[model samples]
Target: MFGIGIPELIVILVIALLIFGPNKLPEIAKSIGKAFADFKKAADDVKSSIEHEITKIEEEGKKTEVDATAPAKGAVEDKEIKK
Candidate 1:
C-alpha cells in the first residue's frame, strides 16, 4: 500500500514465506492486523477528545461575549427609562 507495486509486494511475500514458512503466516498476519486496529482506535479517540475540548472552549467564548454586552445594554435601558 505504501507505494509498493505488485511486483515488489510479490517479492516481499515470497521472502517472508521462505523465512517464516506458510504455517506461521496466518498467525503473523493476525497480530499485525490487531496492532494496526488498536493504533487507529487510539488515534481516533484522541482526535475526538480534542474536538470536544475545542467545542467546549467555543461555547464558553460565546457565553462570555453575551455576558460582556449585558452590562452595557442594561446601562442604556436604565438611562432611557430615567429620561
Candidate 2:
C-alpha cells in the first residue's frame, strides 16, 4: 500500500533478513503487528471518549434550550398583562 511496490517489498524483506535473520523474523513481525494493534486500540478509545463528551454536551444543550424557552413563553404572557 502507500506507494510501496513489489521491488520495495523485496528490498525491505532483504533488509529484515540481513538484520534479524530468518529465525527471529516471525517474532519481530509479530511484535510490530502487536504494536500497531495497540496504537489503533488507543486511538479508538480516545475517539469514543470524545464522542461521549459531545453527546453529553448536546443533551445538556437540549435541556437548557427547553428550560430557557419555557420561561420565555410564560414571561410573554406576563408582559402582555403588565402592559
- Clashes in each model (backbone N, CA, C under 3 Å)? 0, 0
**Best candidate according to lDDT:** 2
Question: Which ranges in model 2 have alpha carbons more than 4 Å from their true place?
Answer: 72-83
Q: Rate the local accuracy (lDDT) of all candidates.
A: 0.93, 0.94
Residue 46 displacement (Å), model 2: 0.6
Per-model TM values vs. the true structure: 0.85, 0.83
What is the C-alpha lDDT profile of model 2 across 1-83, one tens digit per residue? 99999999999999999999999999999999999999999999999999999999999999999887775643567667898
Lowest summed lDDT across 10 adjacent residues in model 2 is found at: 70-79
Top model number, TM-score: 1
**Candidate 1 lDDT for residue 25:** 93
Model 1, poorest ten-residue lDDT window? 71-80
What does candidate 1's lDDT look like per residue over 29-53, in tens digits?
Answer: 9999999999999999999999999
